[model samples]
Target: MCISRRNESLNVAGTMRRGVCLAGCALLCAFSACTMGPNFDAPPAPRAERIEHGEPVADVMDAAGAAQRFSNDATLSRDWWTTFGSAAVDRAVTDALVANPTLASAQAALRESEDDMRAGAGVFYPQIDASFGASRQKYSPLRVGSGQPPVIFNLFTLSAQVSYALDIWGGERRSLEALRAQTDAQRHALAAAYLTLSANVVNTMIAYAAYGDEIAATREMIALVGEQVSVTHSQFTAGVAAYSAVLTLENEKATLEATVPALEQRREQAGNLLAALSGSMPSQWIAPEVSLENIVLPAVLPRAVSSELVRQRPDIRQAEAALHVASARIGVATANLFPSVTLTAGGGYGNRSMNALLSQTGQAWSAAADVTAPLFHGGTLWFERRAAIDAYDQARAVYDQVVLAAFEQVADTLRALENDAHTLDADARALATSEEALRLVQAEYEAGTVGYLSILVADAQRHQARIAWLQGVAQRLQDTVALYAALGGGWYGNADG
Candidate 1:
């Protein structure tokens, strides 16, 4: 500042110049405090906006009907996976929540974000430090006494200096805000990870259950095929049935026997996967032998409106929070282009003698505001601003994708539930018909009218029916899990921002 003395000849131009400088400083402070980058406008919900039309399923089915009824309900039950009503299944899900590696990893990330928030917030507070040290120094002869005598001295420093950023430009404030948003996002991420873990545990349990039924069906078919072979052998020995009939019976038994190993292999594989999900050693973990056929599927499912996903789904909210952080970052980068003002004031007392350190003569005090403006940079500031704008655009796109993907998953799960239930019902009917057909074939063979081969073919049809029914049961269970995940119901369902 060109401080012309008050007594000197002060002109209008001089007064105007000082006024302009003050005004410019004030404006810089104001602009630097501004949020410069693209503001985070929440992405539009095109699919959810027309949810009534957006839903792909007709409301006639029980699954869609439940969804229509609970559109506004919160939390959707923490044990959504346990709706299957099996104590064993409930135990499995609980174990996974406690032991799953993925959830542990996500939890660690959330803790890290919390630390980031603390570190960022620390910038707003004053920093105080004290230094104490003892040193012996030798005075230079030429400087002290003109080569008369060298003096040995002991020195120590024990002063506390406190400094604070003042947040005059609000840059630190904006940065801290960004960190807080990131912490929220990390929390949501933890919730989403939990949802995934729960779904996997449930799905793996169902898969193991289905394989159990397949194993039983295959064994039953093999035994029945053995019975038919024995019947053929007796007839041929009695000179009633042909050698070709016996050959056919042997081939059917062989095919049934082949199915046993494949079914057992699949069951073992499912058990191994379940062990992994539960974070247990496969060598030590043994999945319970459960039948898919006996497991009761949920009669009613939780459903909610499209907008409910934005509030409930952790992944979508995580994405939205991340966008908020990114938007705040733009303000941080923009603040760098303006002058920064920091106000600092401190007072202290010191002396060579400890007793005199408390005297007024040793007292010192100071107060001043340091104003700094950017003099030069190699286009770093401009590029950073442009980058902030680009980051906002990227974050917006990610938010949109997260929302759309969540909506699409819900639509897909609902459709699967409808279709799989219809299929399971049809397969049940087919099983009944197949059993009846075998009965008829057995009666005809007993009357000596139809060949034993006819009974063997009927047995094959019965086995196929049982396999199909078991597969349908498995599909229906997986569809249920999919629906729960698709709706984005998890830990965040009860979370309040």
Candidate 2:
């Protein structure tokens, strides 16, 4: 009997030592184990060797007398708007960045995503909980065959418990990785918002300035037409010009006057849009006065390479981060198919008398380990894993689509800018010819060498040419803004900007 008892004691000691060693090894393995899942790597470079758009040629056409050349490999500053050399433009963008609701929302979303990632990291450590309880119970001595009266008793308990999941298969690590990728995606999205907001403010301001100039030019035309109408009516009264000629002059004057209201209306609309973009009510906001003459176009524009474009564009980077997150999720789903091992330990003191709970003799302790495996779940785990894989494939396709669209935008902007220069040159030439024609005819009419109708014809043509030229100039300016936006708002760095 003595030998048996000694053997039992040895066996119990051996079990306790093995349990401790096993827990220690699990902790070490948790720290050292590799994460399961296909590791995320940056997508490979596009196959195409060069940008599909034509290479930046020399300054071919002078747009509004402001010529520009594309300089490849130049570093674009984050404050690209300041390059326009317009104080009003710079101020407008600054205000919008500070006040815009969309940008604020995006920034808030980024912060939330980062916090979620931080929370997910807690899974790497153990979970601990403290608990206390007090209860009244009745003892059942009759069931125990003690043949004694049942007694009401008070039970008090206090305990602390600890649990940890050994990440042998790396599900928790993959979950954290996925969350980190999501945070990265939100950060890129915020950058994209900044780029978009700034670009919109700049473009809107350009239109506002153009509309103001157009309205002024229209008023000038109205004045000229009014003078031409008086001269034609006097000629008709003298019987030297037909009444129809006077009617034509009157009609031209009215038409010119009519355009003024439309231009004014458009200018007002632009102001209202600027108000919203700057995050204010129209009544409370004042749009800056801008004109083609006052705004300076960039003389040397930076051009990024196709490969660099993917790296610089925020949307592309955002999409790539999403892809990484999707890829990581597949590992999380796959890990669910395997067994989950959990270790739990608890210790506490309990006694029928609350005061006796402090005694060492009332102390108790317990440790347990649990392993759960999916034996049958109606194929749910299998389908979920498959769904995760499909989701990853979908993300890959979407990433490819984003890259293609980004390149397409860059190409469109390049072509628009190239064409704008030529169009501006043509418009400028037409304006010069129209002004000369009007000049000669007006001088002749004053000298009584040409009929009043000749002056009316010249004025009409000159009015159209001036307005067209103004529109062309505005197009060139807006296109420059477009190029900046297409290049992903000039975002690029090793870390968050």
Candidate 3:
């Protein structure tokens, strides 16, 4: 039978012959099963040194130091500013979070990067679209069937289409990985910015507090010196003291008077900075007044441990993430070497007559698939791959530098903590000695047995010793803060998760 012969030929051509279409499908299946690029693997973690120098090389403070340990929580929190334990500091931080312009800008950047990452991921899926259109055409009336009109009827078409580039080589997947890494990098970046902002807020507050304290102290000193100067003038006029001595006393009073304005100016500058951090008016918000008497160091401070630092430092994490992004880019570049298959399919129905619009006989459909392979391009793809390699190398270098810097920071902070402990002890001793000497000199001056210069020198020594003691305390506090920063903790509120 003719029907049976046609069926036999159809089966032979489609099944026995297995032409290019079938072969292409098989090849595509193979491609889909095999990724063309390298698989991503994380780099080895760095081996860090165990002990930092100057960390009680002897066994004296072993028990004291061992009681405190740094945390290894992967995610730091939003309220790191409360570590200072000051309500005013808490309020200031809240204000900054709410209104600080720089933070707002950084937040916007984070959001943009997050959206970009989402978009990059979304592209991996198949794209689908639906469209509808209608049109009318005109024909030459004289040439068309001799009895036909000049105008042609309207036709309408509606259809849905879908297309997807098979990510056979994991090219798109790697691109998504790169985007994900970028998102985390931005997250870490935002964390670093927040940390810096908190530090600035605290530093400004500390400066303001110290400046105010110094101003009050200087004012008292000035008033006392002025009184001393008046008393000395009376003694000189009464022939009890030399005129030159009164002039010297007057000069000292004048110098003390000058310090008041300088301290006030510093206080004002600190206030302005605090205002900026709080994103509020300097005059309206009172900078929380603090003093050496009020500051309470942690009962025990956590020591810097290398393992803890590497795991917690936002900067180091950010650098590592950058490396990830770069590594993914190599995959992206390698993927470009393979061929691309773009599947485009669009089908629609059209009918000139309104009554035939719903008829299957008048419907039309179409589908197509395209494959493109790069033949030659002056080695542009090669250069792109090379550039990707270069970027990976650069990221590696930056990661190396960041980790090295972290180690160095811890080492230096350890050295500073050791030295500052000694400095505080020495300053304490010096202050005590100066105070005793000042008391003895004042007694001798009241008895008229010592020269004014002796009393003046003793007073100067006491004042200098007092100021140095306060400054040393402030330095130690700041140094301690820095030590915690090096350890990647402390200013971080104690809420570890």
Q: What is the C-alpha lDDT of each candidate?
A: 0.76, 0.85, 0.71
- Candidate 3 lands at a TM-score of 0.82
**Of the pair 1 and 3, which is ahead by lDDT?**
1
Q: Per-residue lDDT for 1-497 in model 3, tens only?
A: 99999999999888856777756854885556555345555455566555465344221212212222233332233554455566766766677667787888778888998999989988778898987777897876787558766777787777778898877666788898888888878877776777777767766666666776667666666666776777777788889889998888789879888888888898899888878877778777677767755654433455455655666677887897898999888988977877777887876666776667667876767678888887898999989999998999999899989988988887776666566666777787898998899899989989999866576567666766777666666666666566656655532334321
Task: Answer with 1 or 2, whichever has the higher TM-score.
Answer: 2
**Cα lDDT for residue 253, candidate 1:** 78
123, model 2: CA deviation in Å? 0.5
Task: Report clash pairs, candidate 1.
Answer: none
- Candidate order by TM-score, highest to lowest? 2, 1, 3
Better of 1 and 3 by TM-score: 1
Q: Write the per-residue lDDT of candidate 2 for residues 208-279, one digit (tens) a residue.
A: 889999988888878877887888788889998799987877887788788888888988998898888888
Per model, how many backbone clashes are there?
A: 0, 0, 0
Candidate 1 per-residue C-alpha lDDT over 270-334 given as tens digits, one digit per residue, 9 for 90 to 100? 78887888889999777765666456676656665775678788888899898998888888887
Preferred candidate (TM-score higher): 2 or 3: 2
Candidate 1 error regions (>4 Å): 1-25, 28-41, 47-55, 62-75, 141-149, 345-368, 442-457, 494-497
The TM-scores of all predictions, comma-separated, are 0.85, 0.89, 0.82
What clash pairs does model 2 have? Answer: none
Determine the C-alpha RMSD for candidate 2 after optimal superposition of all C-alphas: 8.5
